[model samples]
Target: MEKSIIIGLDIGTTSVKAVAFSRGGRVIGEQEIAYPLSTPFPGWAEQDPLEIEAATITVIRNLIQLPTIDEKNILAIGLSTAMHSLICMAENGEPLSPSITWADGRASLQANRLRVEHNHIYDLTGTPIHPMSPLVKLIWMKENNYLPYQQASYFVSIKEFILYRWFGCQSVDYAVASATGLLDLHHLKWNKEALELAGVSEAQLFKPVSPTEVLVDLDKTIADQIGLPVHIPFVIGSSDGPLANIGLGAINPGEVAITIGTSGAIRQIVTEPKSDSLQQTFCYGITESLSLIGGPTNNGGIVLQWLKETLDIKETYEELISVAEKAEPGAEGLLFLPYLNGERAPIWNANVRASLFGLSLRHKKEHIVRAGLEGVIYSVFHVGQALERLAGKPTTLLASGGFGRSPLWLQITADVFNQEVQVPISHQSSAWGAAWMALFAIGEVTDLASIKQAIPMQENYMPNPDHHKIYMDLFKLYQELSHTTHSIYMK
Candidate 1:
């Protein structure tokens, strides 16, 4: 008898990954393939959907062929993808345009206009008014008469496009659709008002389905190529942000999940749908009854990467973090506003650029680096503050992402948030969440709560009282600087 395995396919911005996991919550095999994000013009971030589709197929094939895995024993495959990727397609499944990623800012002007004129849209959709939303992107396309937009037979997300290519259906999960700024969060359907605003109709959009929806009978040729049975179940998992909460076992009330991969977010699951009044957070659906309300930051480990490359520093991430640790908790009064790639949540401004304030002769290279790192944490903390106002304080902070590999970073997060931070043994939260969704869909898992017991945990980081005090004091100054500088960035 062979061990049963579940596969989770994650379609990310810069890469596609497939991880095979056993029913007992252990990784069996994994494969990853990287792709490039193209910048044809300033503020325009796009990717070739064909390349991503090919990369996804290749990763799945590679994972199934791993020596430790037998394709026949694979019980199911679940999908988890980045949110807010828009692709225009022809009727024959050919892409009419490159996939516009969430990072794309070509729609900034449209977003700004809507944000000022139709602020109520954010209240209804639960998505912030920003260029990242496909709603704004559609407005840009309509106004500019983008060739692809005019010729498109359908407008779909990258995940929906993949599903159409594989299963011959055009469907999108609730979570992914909700992030598009076009879904009615309260009713769990397309918003008529949003369609009118975007100048499109419900006919042009994919049918929204539940995340647990299962599809069978894969394409015969592709199934044979990937060595999977034609009838294997494929679970339509939720987007990465909500799924990361499940992967980290943060489902219980008041358990906040903080992830800092290329980007960062602070999310908590709620029993009911709720949007922020101040528009400081977004409310995306996970299930019919459960929604995720949180703030996402455009800056995270990517900020550190930018610092390393721009400074031309040859040090490894570990070494760089070590240098950052040399500076005190507050970085000796130096402040950094990390809006290098614009910002989301807390600010929701795409025009804003990065800034280093309070820089003086006293600050050195180490201080600058430390401020950068601390700045990222402070920004995330700012989001947490907004979350606290709406959802109450988090009982536990479950940290997952590239930053978790650094103990100093983990400690900083704990101190800055003034709470205990728990790291999962597995950093692949989204993939693991997708695998768990597959298991649940196929009756391999009895309940969602069972995942908490199966997932292994690491030691918790407790905040240092002295450091927390310092961060609290400095946070006031950070807030003041943030508020005062908002106008300057708008200009």
Candidate 2:
């Protein structure tokens, strides 16, 4: 008997991953292709849209060619993408500007202005006024007279641009659109007020659709290039954050999903649209009836990467982690704030710099490494606290991402948050979530809720009361230091 399979294509910040899953939630085949992120100027991050699109095609084609994958048994392909990428395109579908990713802060000045002038914008869109938002990016473009902003006939995300290439239509899933700061959370449509503020019209935006919306009849020329069937069904899966929650069975209230890869976030699913009173968290729409509330941290495993390169460490990643494990908890009174790449959530400030507080002559290389890990986990804990305020305390945490692979990191996260953390056996939670959504869309699965039983889980980490107590005090000091230095770093 031939086995059936579903493909989940995840467009992440660092790489594009194509995963093939069996009906039993087993990964049969997978491929990943990394792409480069360009920083033309300090604080500005961009990527070539065509390069990402090519990477996407390469991964899918490579997956199809795998000996374990049978094309005839392929059911559907679902997409999972990083949120808050903006692209300007000409009417003929050519990109007029480089893709501005979520990490880009060229519009910091504009974002700060919006935060003061349009405080109500957060309440309406459920997205914070940040340079990461397309709304702010558009305003910056308009004010600076970016050629693409003026000549472009339409504005869309990388996902929509790819969809336009594949299906010849500019369609955006609700989850992706919600992160743009231009969608009305209540109405599930483009907000006229936001458009006016952005100096753009609804006509420039893609049509917003549900996550499970399916598109058939692939573009023949492109289909042949990628070795996909012309009539294969494509499901427009939601953003990576919400899909990661779904993949980990963290969709219910009180179940929080935490991911730490190139970046970090702590999110919970709610039945209605909501935001933090202080605008500390983002509440992006998942479905008409479901919203994702959470905070994102700019620092994650990437901080460790920076450390490894900057320190000229020659050891493998596992070896470096072993070095960190040698240092005792709290790094012997050395506290690190993991804001090397600015910050988000709890403060929403991007101008703050990372600091190593309480550093003494006793601190060594291992201590610095250990402090870096603690700092990253502590940042998540900080964000998690804000989420706890808005959504009540999270009863469960479903963990995913590169950081989750580290037993030490996982334990640190659990201990810092003072909560039990569960990791899925499959690390590709975002891709799995997208695959499950594909299954539901094609009627292969009965409902989204049934996915819980289908997913396999690994060991759980319980917070040690002793460790939690110590972390609580250290976190308080971290908070004080952040507040004390805030005025010094404001750009």
Q: lDDT of each structure?
A: 0.90, 0.91
Tens-place lDDT digits, model 1, residues 1-491:
75488888889888998988877668888899999999999999999999998888789989988899888888889999999999999888899999999999999889888988999998889999999999999999999999999999899999988888889877889999999999999988999999999988899998888888899989998787676788989999989998889889899889999999888999999999989889999999888888999999999988889889977889998888888877888889889988899899898988787889889998877888899888899999999999999999999899987888889889999999989999987788888899998888878888676889877788889999999999888889888877766667777
* Candidate topping TM-score: 2
Candidate 1 regions off by >4 Å?
none
Instruction: List TM-scores for all candidates, in order.
Output: 0.98, 0.98
